[model samples]
Target: MKEQSSRKGFAKFTTLDIVLMAMLAAANAVMTVYLSQVNQALNGLGGPIATSTITGLYMIYGLLAYYIIRKPGTALITYGIGAVVQSFMGSAYGILSCFAAAACYLIIAEAVFAAFRYKNWSLPVMMFTGGAMVPVWFFFAAQMFGYTKWGTGVLLVALCVRIMSGILLCGLLTKLLGDALSRSGLLRRFAVSRAVES
Candidate 1:
């Protein structure tokens, strides 16, 4: 009986779910290579602040996958697959950094959704989730990229920019894209489409 219940629970993820996650992960991996060059140029132009502006874009795919799937482990699985895809795509951040980035996103995204019991898909909640994913990874990145040496004021400004970017680029963009996809009837079999219809 217990094994049957477990299987039933796992069955929540249809094959479509797996396929969508893989597609999003692969897209993210390819985008990461291009974005890294953009980030490098931005960093050169305006320092951490400029680079921070696009940080949320790096996180969008996993958040988008979760928004569309609305499942407990959606972000985690998507991000994990993204890390693997990024490795093969030759990310400038190195394989370890790619995995680390995914891990960072997984931690915050899972915790935020789990905290809400994975039920609240409201705009505010999504924005909060996106903004929340920034800080912990920012902590890790500060040390790695020497952002700590940039003085407290500069660090705080950069952090704020990143959080806002997360809210707009990652969270808001995910919601909008999900809704658009839902409307197109392409996501008809997904949880998000059901949510939209009801």
Candidate 2:
């Protein structure tokens, strides 16, 4: 029999895993509403840069899910579900855009994780994945909102701010939260907890 600690069965999801994903999806739904309000509040005062800064918080759902699940495609499945939940909750950009954005984000994150062979969840790796969404976001925004008109300089500046936000909020904050949860023994069944034990 394959040892429980082995990654051989990591590709499969258990009923408990499905239930956890659903709960995370629901949490993401709440975050979407909260983020919309935060975006609205920041929009007039801070423009795209300010708004995107807060977007790092959006990465939390995927990060937390991935940390716990520690499975290939976990980010894709969790965040894709998050987008659907957000769409049903009513996104101004519509359901399709949310889905597309989630898909793009997943691609970036998966690439980063894959680069490490999904064995190293080091800070640098996490930070790289956290910021990976910026390029994808820039392309998607240009297509959706004619953001190209803003000029490359302005866009680049906004992207930098977003990357920093991702590093701090998504990468650092997720690590902090994961550590706290692991320490509390609340995540004892998760891979992260096992990693901590080892």
Candidate 3:
């Protein structure tokens, strides 16, 4: 059946789709700047923190994008694009590493999704993807900004923050955005496929 064979029908994205993705990127960029400021303000208060964890929230954007689009490049494109937007908006992470981390997110996500036939769509996997992207961000940060300030406890602090941010923020944000997209009829394409599968 032509209807059954139409991949486009299952996920037909338009200008609105692209625009929405870019808007999300901008929103995420603004969020990062705000979060960083908050982190800076609370540094001396010792609110149980580490090197830098907002990168976890950064990955959340990809999670949400991929979840909604259910497309191969959605995670990669949106996030990479987001970073570019973030840099132009004056991100502390800089344009280069933001792009690098975005590339890593996209690549890792593609591999993960492929392994699952692109149908697993589970929370754990989302967290794994988020965590996987952590090093890219941290390493980039360390290289560009240096972690000497954190002293002898840098590794422990960085890893802990990675675990917390990746597992919690990215995964939760993905679930939230995915749910919202489904409710908005944007995921109708998925519904058609599942109905036939059942």
Number of clashes recorded per candidate? 0, 0, 0
Give the Å error, residue 148, model 2.
Answer: 2.0
RMSD of each: 1.5, 3.5, 5.0
- Model 3 pairs whose backbones collide: none
**What are the clashing pairs of model 1?**
none
Q: Please report, as a residue range, the 10-residue window in candidate 2 with the lowest summed lDDT.
A: 2-11
Point out the worst 10-residue segment of candidate 1 by lDDT: 91-100
Q: Across residues 32-107, which tens digit of lDDT does each residue of candidate 3 receive?
A: 8888777776665653354355547767877677766566667666887787888888866567767877787777
- Give lDDT tens digits, candidate 2, residues 52-126: 788678777787777777778787788888888888888866777788878877888777777788899767777
lDDT of 3: 0.68
lDDT of 2 at 36: 83
Indicate whether candidate 1 or candidate 2 has the larger TM-score: 1
Best by lDDT: 1
lDDT at 124, model 1: 94
Enumerate residue pairs that collide in model 2: none
lDDT string, candidate 1, 1-198, tens digits: 999987886789889999999999999888888999999999899988999999889999999999999888888899999999999888776788788878999999999999999898989988888899999889988887678999999999999999999999998888999999999999998989999999
TM-score against truth, every candidate: 0.94, 0.89, 0.77
TM-score of 2: 0.89
Q: What is candidate 3's CA lDDT for residue 18?
A: 73
Off by over 4 Å in 3: 1-13, 51-53, 148-152, 184-198
Worst 10 residues of 3 by lDDT: 189-198
